[model samples]
Target: MRLLSTIMLALFLVFSMSGAVLAQEAQTNTTDPIIVGNQDAESLQVVQSYFETMDSNLLAEDVSYFDEQSIQAIEGRDMLTQSPTFMYGDSFTEQQLTPLRYIVTEDVVVVEYTFVGRNTGSYATLPATNQLVSVPTVGIYHVEDGQITGIREYMDSDDLYTQLGYPAYTGVQPVAPFTLPEPNAVDDIVDNPPAFYGQEVTIEGGFGEMVGPNAFTLWDEDFIDIGQEGLLVLAASDGAFDFTPVEETMLRVTGTVYEYDRASLEGTVGYALDEGTFTDYQNFTVLVASEIANMDNVDTLANVDQQPESFYGQTVTLEGHIGDTVGDSAFVLFRDQLVGVGGRVLVIAPDFDPATVENNQVQVTGVVQPVDAPTIVTETGLTLDENLLSDYQDWTALIANEVMSVE
Candidate 1:
């Protein structure tokens, strides 16, 4: 009887120890146990789906959890997103949302979460500062029939701007005037010329063959077929109207669109069109210009020389031949055809390998800055020649973003 009692006690101890180990293992392996609080299960599940959609970077168009009427109503109020709430995935990357608290009633479910992501896109007209933001946000959602009926999100906008390296918002800020008109396609204008009559507009397309000294045929940028419809442009009498007649170059013309009246247009531009030369444009739509300029942003090195101040401190894409190297990280970019006009500009690229661009046509996208030797040396750590530095002072220099061979 003594031996049996001792055996029975040992069995009980073993069983108790085994039961505790099994309980711990089960707890450790449990998957997302429902966080229970003053919350209704049905409403909490609906709210959980809403956040899951955000975590997956799925927009309203891509998901069906949101009510159609709620989305429409929210979009009507939010002009920037055109949605009920801010979509983090639209402007941010690697979004991580942590729900801190959930306050649920019979119909309303409010969730407080922390939002974190890297800002890689422009928002509210502010440039991308590439900063990371971790902001606390609250979203009040109205649920019915396991669907969201309405949503109201609250967050500190000023805090968002501050995190993005911008000044804190006051009541008002200055907005640049939008003076330039939106550009119209040449084909669109040509096909429906009457629709654009008398409207002051801008058209961008190829420098499609020149019709006269002050006149040219403008067609779609890629139009190649013969007899393609073109818009006739009668340039302004102002000397500002000058362009290389290369078909590869694009040009922007801003003027009033009108039915081509040969005699009237001749009187307006102070130049008569040749009868045979402009016969194709008779009674057709034409643009009587106030301005005509290159549409491309600094396509050639020579353009930078002509307007150095305009490009100074601005980023530009320059195409030219890589001239002699200045140092391990610096070289000169110039166009062979533009040598006479001093098309050469100094370029400094720390990450670029010069061998790739040797004797090759290259395109360099970089910021255009004035050649100040002290600043260049300080910023780029390049040891440029003293004589070369003095000679190129106040001239334009490009701190390259990339140097690619254009074969």
Candidate 2:
């Protein structure tokens, strides 16, 4: 009986070992090159092909691959009730995808691709310009039961701007030629001013002081103003562009003109010149200012900040306050003006006695010239006038023109 039991035990051990080996072999087979018969591998291929087809459809502006029951969730809220629909026809075109590393784990798939676009139409109210932009985007796709259920995309708007030749200015104006039409040619310029009373003309000027939050004061050597009221302001030449952080100087702007009423006066206010008017032109140039102020002040500061090279030896009025008194001899002044979004304060300093300026509400009058570098740091963190500081002894001193009493 003992011998029979031993033989039975040995047979049992061999069968158990055989089962363990088979299990190991099965695990190894699952990791080998995916076979066409494998359901999971087939599902992965289908998902990848779907993405490729969807990319092609997006380029063609055809919204079909979306599931009939699919919904679009933007920023956590469902934006669509049924399948994704395109309200506007072909808003995005010229889509190219550069495949980056992709990872598929369990039920989640992540794809990284560089999306390059050109001549793309605007998605919503953003105008469709011929600007070429490239953005690196990552998409997270959640898959369940062999079907992709959700997708999310991530990218940065500032990165998109940088790809389109729009770099944030550092508050330093560059040297550029300024060409204004002859006074006699004013009749040929576009002169459709806003309904509000104000003159519309394209003028070339250097950047001036910044006033309120996003507004800057513009000035030209030849341009003159009557009073500080009545103006309709907008940013950009076509009145479509707007920006933030008003302390960054150096821009070229063109817009309409309107009168500013008492109720509209918020920041530092300027008036429109009645004599100058553009008959056939609708744009103007704003070469330099602390920052592009707000759209409301664009009409007032437009054409006031001309190109720096145009005002090489001209005295200009700049507003701001004493920021940093470099020494007893010199201190930097901060001025505000409107340019892009609202307005910002610019820093202006010269080689002079800083003792004269008591507070931050002092104005400075100085010659507008090109500085190889910036000498002043605006309150908004942009540096200006760094180059020509050696010529002036106290790089921080500024000539105060007017001092406003702030309570």
Q: Candidate 1's residue-wise lDDT over 12-121, tens digit each?
A: 33532465435644564343322323445676777887687742222232222221112112232223234323555257887888775565555556566778888887
Q: Per-residue lDDT tens digits of candidate 2, residues 310-396?
A: 444556554433444443334444322211221112223433443433223444465444332342343214344344345543222
Clashes per model (N, Cα, C within 3 A): 0, 71
In terms of lDDT, model 2 sits at 0.37
Q: How close is candidate 2 to the true structure, as a TM-score?
A: 0.26
Report lDDT (Cα) of residue 352, candidate 2.
41
- What's the CA RMSD for each of the models? 25.9, 28.1
Residue 102 lDDT, candidate 1, scale 0-100:
60
Kindly report which residue stretches of model 1 are placed more than 4 angstroms away from their true locations once superposed.
1-277, 280-292, 295-300, 337-342, 383-388
* Residue 312 displacement (Å), model 2: 66
- The Cα RMSD in angstroms, rounded to one decimal, for candidate 2 relative to the true structure is 28.1
